[model samples]
Target: MNITFLDSSTLHHKNDLDLSPLKQFGDLTLYETSSIEEIATRIADAEIVITNKAVLNKELIEGAKNLKLILSAATGVNQIDLEAAKAHDITVCNVAGYSTPSVAQHAFTFLLNFATSIPKLDSEKQQWPQSPIFTRLDYPAFDLQGKTLGIIGLGAIGKEVAKIAQAFGMNVQALNSSASSAPSGEIPRVNLEALLKTSDVISLHCPLTEETKHLINRESLSMMKSTAFLINTGRGPLINEPDLAEALDKGIIAGAGLDVLSVEPPAEDNPLIHSQHPNLFITPHTAWATIEARHRLLDGLVENIKNYLAGCPSNQVV
Candidate 1:
């Protein structure tokens, strides 16, 4: 019953995780590296592999003869090869809903920054001493009240965001992934095109999938209001970065605030890095890494490992 955590550094560096429960089940080994090449060696003799960013493909999975469980610390399992794990009889589980609050809060933070032009105002205030007093009055901010908030993928996190938006007097609407299971109640579900055309502030909260990848592109950007702002806290590939940069340059929309990008630690050549607009806000993908959320994720991962050893695994993906 060997349990090895590859890339434990992601969780270890944040909070003090109680590994007492995990230790009770089996021998535990923790590693810091997330590289595929590194993980292949570290997980060689382990029965259960706990990972946050390490990629477990067929090549790596086949090498781990004793591996029986794959416990992903986070919700997204895109880094793991699910089909291969299923074929190998490896139980794959992921922690979900743990980051709902953290991610939802981050989405609103971006929305507020765009709605109020907080960054531009903050920058201007720093230079106020050199400017005329009249310049201060030029940058008026808008209120969130009466604005239409369009949400894409009204899942738990999106619903939470809608509830908060309602508190600020915002009219909320959503675009559902499937037409039949449309989100009901106060947040009426609308089509993608309609959401883009009518929303004053569009926020993305959907998972990244084949159908959802590049959901926001040049054509969709063109449908948005010139004054509308786009906020994405869901996944990076959900929006096309190049198309978004072009839109920002041409003023296709008012601006954008992205917490996720097509590439993590985006390349220096990325357009968003050098966009010529004061309206764009780019944050390192920290929307789901809040302390509270990380704790929940850790708890879930340990529970999954315990359950797997107990012969009744919870959160099993395969």
Candidate 2:
């Protein structure tokens, strides 16, 4: 079998994450990046195609005559045309739970920055050292010990984050999207409105769908406490960028710490990208880019390939 990874650099960089595990497979062709115009030709001879972030549209899916299995290097399959793949009998698998620890850790990495105001304090290097006062209390820092953490999504990542929040002596509650599947005893499930109204911190771990897009807009922002903070490490479109920017500027909420934006490599005019608000902090969408997480993703990818070859498909989305 000829397996092609359209974007290989994302999975393995240098010797950090090796591709030797995949050598057991017949043959592999790797491309660091592929343009929209180059996808069809590059995947033309591939029996199995693997990609991260590259769009596998219906036309490209149809154009690949030998393509049998399509593996998404990430959990989300938004880039692939699932309907078209189903029409052509192509098996699609995505690795999930690979980023649970990474994402959970990153959520706090952002939250802690906000709670401690580390960046703000660190930026005042000269002022802090030259000050007459031994202790620099110029900027305020909050504690996470007794705060309420409301998680919007209750999947693997959200659940992991809840555990960490509990360890910090914080109260963890989740928005109950499923009444029948509410978490037992530990994390109380609340309604969306209630979660928005009462929580000290709100984190989004939900998928971006038509209903969830712009979920944290003006109305929802108004519902949160003025001192509350927002964290998004999930899909970008889950929050309204412009509204979030305005909210930060107007002090609607204390701050926002995001690992995603409404757009990737956001346009220069993107409100969030240009905000530069004292409280808003953003990381370049790397909540799941940890080396250990990448290894797990590769392991799942290999398992999917091996299972498919054995006439048993694993992690099938379609």
Top candidate when judged by TM-score against the true structure: 2
* lDDT, candidate 2, 1-318, per-residue tens: 999999998787776888878778878888888999999999999999999988999999999999999999999898999999999999999998899999999998888887887888888887876888887887878889999999999889999999989888899888985533454686788888889999999999998889899999999999999999999999889998888888899999989889998878888899888877888888988999999999899999999999999999999997
lDDT of each: 0.86, 0.90
True-structure lDDT of candidate 1: 0.86
Q: Write the per-residue lDDT of candidate 1 for residues 1-318, one digit (tens) a residue.
A: 888988877775643665556677678887776676688788899998988888898899988999999998888887789998999999999998999989899999988887666677887777777776646755568899999999998899999999999999999988954434443565677788888999999999888889999999999999999999999998899999999999999989988989999988799999998987888888888888887887898889878877777889898888
Clashing pairs in 1: none
Using all chains and alpha carbons, the TM-scores for the candidates as numbered come to: 0.93, 0.96
Query: What stretches of model 1 exceed 4 Å from their correct place?
Result: 14-21, 129-135, 177-184
**For candidate 2, what is the lDDT?**
0.90
**RMSD in Å for all candidates:** 2.3, 1.7
